[model samples]
Target: MRRLASGPDILLLAAVWIVDVAVFSTLLNRSDSPSGLLRAPVVVGYAAVGAAALLLRRSHPVWVFAAVWLHSCAANLLPLGVHPTAGVLVALYTVTASRGEAVGALAMVAGFVPLGLTVAAEVRAAAADERITILTANAIFFTVVGLLVWGLGRWVRANREHARELERRRLAEADAAVAVERRRIARELHDIVAHAVTVMVLQAGGAQQILGTDAARALRTLRQIEDLGREAMGELRRLLLVLRPSAGDEAQQPVDGHQPGLDDVDRLVGTFREASLPVRLGVCGAARRMDRSTDLTAYRVVQEALTNVMKHAGPGTRTRVELNWADALSIRVTDDGGSPPRRASAPSAGHGLLGLQERVDVVGGTLTAGPTRDGGFEVNAALPVPTTEPDRARSGG
Candidate 1:
């Protein structure tokens, strides 16, 4: 940082100051031949003060103004330099860029007072026997410069404040979006694992009633229920982790590995099949591979769609699951006919589609669910295939 601060970049601004002094000194000499008061050493002193003011311009804007004021008074009184006020202009610019409005305003008034006095004194002395036009002109110039400096400072501060405000608003919007995503995720867990576990417990009990005659089959059914409970817990843990990366005691671990893919669809469809629901599963296009997140989303979308079917369309409904892996992966689940054999004990359990919609949105995909013309419920979903490794890497990474 020290090296950067001391680097040659600042020499450019220093050079401009030096050039201004040389030209103005030449003009002063041309306009007023060496009145013995205008000596080389005195002119050099004025330049030294102006250069020093420029050196600490950013760090000490008020000090720069003070130094330039002293130099300006000397130059103008003897008219030793034609451009007496350029160093003051530089100081004004420094205050504009760095200082706050109230402080800059104080510095402006402080600088203008001494400056106007010096010009007024010079005018009184130089135009002793002349009209007062020169004095009025000098006063007007001082007032204009004071107003200009104050205006510049105000403008810069306003712009800086506006930029900061915009940044704050943008961050607020991002936080709100994340909060909304978390709420939707919570709702999905309530419907999926919570409902699935309840159904599994009930199914396991039913299997036990005929346990003696079909003892082996009953055990197999019990095991399937245990497997499902574990699966739901695993999915639940993963969803919790994704929602809360920083969750500690509250942290629910993410499902460690990727979400199950097309291969796992068979296992999912088989769960209902074992329960004696007629389920037809279909696949099209290449069974393209994908990241775990999309697989999870696909899993959840299918899971919720099916869950809704069983909840609303009822038990013994014929369900069809289709996976199309063409340009993008598409999932469709249709219940051509199945109203719960009996009305469900719970009627409000069909709201899982809200969670499904959020899952699809996270992947920049889309999902839609509604009744079909053929007297069935249909869920049609399309998830964009992450076409490149970079995109997949970003989501996975």
Candidate 2:
């Protein structure tokens, strides 16, 4: 609530004052009686004060209503008779609009009290025949107008509350969308950087061991490292574009030519094998077409699982990856326990499984990873595939 009146409040006060003064002057003009003319200035002065009270109606609705009520009663009791004035009705509207139903109901009854008393006084002073008619008409008219004004105020209050509720809902939805996007960006960073760095470390170590005895093999390993490094840089550039892209780059391709999916799993396994981590790939059932998100999630599950084996397992550890295409695509990557590494295991930040779970969830899949009974580790995932698409096209078919 405002402590001081606003522009609209001043305008409303001016409008009501003009209306009240005009009506009072018109009644005074029609009556040529000397007593009515003498009281004219006093009535206008009191009406001015009531209209001015409207300025503070929003801040002090109850008090404003009381002042206006007194002004209306004085008009009737002082023999310059007027029905309940516009000031009293405006005050009633403010009370109901600002203070709500229970308080507004009280204000309505308070407003009618003075009018009732003035009417009863007039009926007693009049002739016996005219008393009943005056009482009935005034009572009916005033009650109906009072209820309509109160109801209009309540309608305005309800509309304001409804608008506020819609604004709150819109803000909440925006916040939730921001949180989800941050998690997705975090997941992408972990998957791309972690896997590439792990492969490079193993390749570097393998090259160092054979550098002097077999120069040719060392050279080949270094070339693979150079190629892998370039690929990682390209992927990072693509991810960066997603984070903060220039207008020109909006039409550019994502990273290299095409995004990696299930079809690229074989090449992914080949990359790990080149780094001296023994890997074998197997497939069963006819592969079916999948949506982009589900295809990418399936590939990532295998990539993350194999990357984990290289990071935490021994040097001679062997990994097997299986893809079972069915109504739902089922994937499994298992690593056989091997001789302990000659050096300390690589450091782990442990975001692999956590990110994998979130990615799998996005595509409506389930992922589980744990040590097997045979002293090996295994990651298993089942991703649902939409059957409404064409069968996956195989090369040279």
Candidate 3:
């Protein structure tokens, strides 16, 4: 299980506790130096309670603050003067920071009100010559301590918000990665099983046609059918594990035999032609190549861009596909609306834009999607392309 509280954050709070304890202990010791609490067990006990309360201030803020406040008004039965009172400020700091704005402000006010009253009482008890001096000193102390705690509060708040934003971005990336993997697995299952089933059906039909007259041939066809069936079962088992494998099974499963990437753009365009979309594939700049991540990112950008076009643009529109092989892999898929018929799902029904944005961003790429001046929805993504692997992309088989 994850640790309940983060160690570093707690340690910072612990530092506040130690400083508070030290400040009070020093003041109490000095205040009782001549007429020591060591001379009286009762005063010594009260002082011990006050100091320990400082250490536990963050852990038990309310109780510790209240105990300190009561002791502040309880005469020499308490520790010392204003120095011992710094513990309440530490509690206020913890309370304000850990709780929300409402509770934090309320807790701060609770601490401040008592502190103000006690300081005012000390001012009243001072001799006339030292009255202004004592009041001024107390005012400065409050100012310094209050500002210090306020600065600490701001730092704590800023760090907390930054940490939250980092966590949110991480979680979003993980979700998108999982989604991409799931969709790829689905496409593989569609391709693999569909082809296997088609072959199995044809073999079964042929075997049925001459079962009695061509018994030997029929047996051969049946054996072939059994082979295909076992292959289908193995593929199905692997796909199921990919979709939702038990933990140990997940570790040993073979990866899918799919390397869909940028080099396959021509074949991808051929499919749109099979579906009767007037799509064109164009390549510019010197021939270059990319790693699997870059290639896959480039391909997915095109795939999503085309998918968007099919769903958003006119069917009769002439689509232009441009893949610039340069410092950046520039993808521009725009359409002039195809012929015959046009139909599409709602814009929000597709998460292609969100998915594409995530893909490009991961590879330090940029994507811009909107309608062009010609009333055509256009997508432009500039992805990082490497220079050294032209051979691999050219030899794509």
Candidate 4:
């Protein structure tokens, strides 16, 4: 019932009914001819039916327009005389609003025929001087009113379509952004877990090999493995915290607590040395504090390159990690060790290089990783340094 007659529907129905009553009353009071009086009841009944048809206009706009239009024409044809009612205009607006431009044009043309005919009838009954005046005035008045109503409906329909199109574009952009962010998060997780576990594996293997021959060294290796495990767990927890929504006191804690930066690269190198890899670190040019993101990317590049060396170059490889700080930071990790040793659980997804490339690109940097001419592998990256106000002031314009 509510769908059939909403609040606006009831109000429209009442308005149309009132217009019908007013038109009928005016016809009865204005005319004095006996023939006109006799036809008055028929015209009044026709107007009532046309106005009632407005109730279904929203559901069947074209059909309602045709029905109301035919009834209006029949009423006008009667000798008694009838005037244009609100029902005709209402039906015309509904057709234009719902049926689009092509059908609305047809309805407009159909409506014009009756109006022209009514004007012609009025002209035939007037004196010669008044005939021309009445014809011109009625033609101009009806044409202007009809076109205004039709144009208003078309304008409203166009605005509604435009709004819907904007909403669709907004939702599509949002979905694309979400997909890109998911890929980024996946890459970050891979880098963190892969590097940490690889070191742990090397330490465990060293502990196993030296257990019978050297008890003190084996125990030291085991302790190192425990420390690596605890560090990995802490990093994993931080990553997980980002996914969970916080409440109360937890909300105040930072999501990233002491994220690794360039300063931590020395510590990272120490861990690899403990795993029995002979690694060298070289720094050239002056070192200065860099932006958080650039610092993080530089650290990850070194970390990933060293991890790859551990996996592919095997133990006892002479590896070199170089950091050249100039206009941009240049990182290169190279190993003299040959092919990788086969292992049962050598964690591989083939996404390590790809993830490194993505991280480099995000900081407007470039990364190159492939075999070197020396029968070894090399990973090189160049990351741009972000300028700060202090640097600008010191350099001078």
Root-mean-square deviation of each candidate, in angstroms? 14.7, 18.5, 13.0, 18.8
Give the alpha carbon lDDT tens digit for every residue of 1-397 in model 2: 5457778878888778767666633345545777767666765676677788788787888988998888777766666544336788899988888886799889878878765765665576568999899788867876888889888889988888889899897655544443444345444644665677789999999999999999999999999899778757755654553353212111112365355788888788888888898888888777787655567778879988988888778556988888887788899998875564322224232456655676676556898877776667888999988675547643210
Candidate 3, 1-397: lDDT as tens digits = 6443466645644554455444433344445565543434444444456555665555666676678767655632333433345556766676666666776667666666656655665577679898899788977777677657755765687789889999898766556555665455444554666677899999999999989899999999999899778767755764564464222111111267565787678888778777667888887766575544556678788877777777766354678888777777788988654443233222332455765675566556899877654556678999876556565433211
After superposition, the stretches of candidate 3 with alpha carbons farther than 4 Å from their true spots are 1-44, 54-59, 73-83, 121-126, 241-397
Tens digits of per-residue lDDT for model 1, 287-334? 555544566688777767777777676668888888777678899988
TM-score, cand. 1? 0.55
Which 10 consecutive residues of model 4 have the lowest summed lDDT?
388-397
Q: What is the clash count of model 2? A: 0
Which ranges in model 2 have alpha carbons more than 4 Å from their true place? 1-11, 18-31, 73-84, 117-128, 210-397
What lDDT does model 4 reach? 0.71
Worst 10 residues of 3 by lDDT: 245-254
Residue 188 C-alpha lDDT in model 1: 53
Point out the higher-scoring one by TM-score: 2 or 3.
Answer: 3
- Lowest summed lDDT across 10 adjacent residues in model 2 is found at 244-253
Q: Candidates' TM-scores?
A: 0.55, 0.50, 0.52, 0.50
- What is the TM-score (0 to 1) of candidate 4? 0.50
1 or 3, greater by lDDT: 1
Root-mean-square deviation of Cα positions for candidate 2 versus the true structure, in angstroms: 18.5
Ranking by lDDT: 2, 4, 1, 3
lDDT of each: 0.65, 0.72, 0.64, 0.71
- Where does model 4 exceed 4 Å of error? 20-26, 30-41, 78-85, 121-129, 210-397
- Using lDDT as the measure, the top candidate is 2
